[model samples]
Target: MHLKKLTVVALSACFGLSACQKEEAPPAAPPASEAPAPARAESAPQQPVESMPPATATAPGSGSNLIREPVAAQEQPLQAIQTKMGPKESVIHLTSAKVTGQILTVEFVAVPKKRGDGRYEWLNLTLPLKNVSYIDDATAKKVSLLQDDGEAYMASPLNGTGKSIRLDGHSPITATLKFPAPPETSPTISVNFSDIGSFDGVPVSR
Candidate 1:
């Protein structure tokens, strides 16, 4: 009886140790796709973008800038003629005629004339001005004023305005008219001032 009890105790101890070993065994290996991924490296910082500057604007030349003066103000010594004008008449006297290179300059003063309405009008002339050139003694051909590329006559501006000059009735305004010079063979030329009539034997100096 004692031998059988000892055999039973040894078998029970062997079974308990086997059950503990089975419970403590490691878990089954997971599938390759289910495994945790490796960690990623940190990225470098981004740079900032710069903006461009705006363009600058430019201006064009004004009317005053384009006007060229033919003669200086001081060089022209104006004289006051006491003689008056009659009604229904416009008077212009050729004071001086000067030939310089290819140009012939004629300086004249317009006498304050009485209008047909009996009102006295002073000299008021416009720019890019035009005048009558009826004769040239040298060529015997009618000479015209020199024209620029813009078709404007090369003449002094009426005033600093590049426009017209307006003078008071009491004061005489001396103005200049330029024409293409006649041939050097003639020291004088006849200029017909349209309705004002022709000024013959007008002397030309250098």
Candidate 2:
């Protein structure tokens, strides 16, 4: 009986020690889904870059962006005068003579012969005519002006009425003539007619 009791005590002590050991052991690890995640790093903001304008190439043998200068012009010289008046001739009377710049103006009166019954006659259609004659045979080109230095100026057809006169004479007719300018220093001149004589020592006016 004593031996059976000792065996029962020893078994009770072993059971108690096994229960304490099981209680002292650590717990099992957690699942991957339940674990905490690692922290993320913070980043700085980026700046925007500025775009520049395109450059232009200059033309060959050309200047810069500044404006260019203007060029100058050329000019001509003026003409001079020498004399004004000329002598008078028969059948032709000089009424006036004047000078203005490079132009010369002369006025005169001419008396022509009466017309004959025939269609053409020497006295009727000939001699010299004026601006108001009925005959178309005479022209102002018949007259000319000469300087004291022997320089002669011819009448210009562009200055006057540019019409030729005919001699169907009833009365004296008046006419005007134009000539090129003479030298500025000429003090005396003469007027000459193709058929009539020349007049001299005529005065010059402004």
TM-score of each: 0.45, 0.33
| Model 2: CA > 4 A from native | 1-90, 112-169
lDDT of 2 by residue, 22-119 (tens): 77553433444345433211212212112211122344224432333222121331122222221121145566667788756666655443356623
C-alpha RMSD for every candidate? 17.9, 27.2
lDDT of 1 by residue, 46-86 (tens): 22112212111112233333442334444565443222332
lDDT of each: 0.59, 0.43
Q: Which segments of model 1 are wrong by more than 4 Å?
A: 1-90, 113-131, 156-170
Reference-based lDDT, residue 184, model 1: 80
lDDT of 2: 0.43
RMSD of 1: 17.9
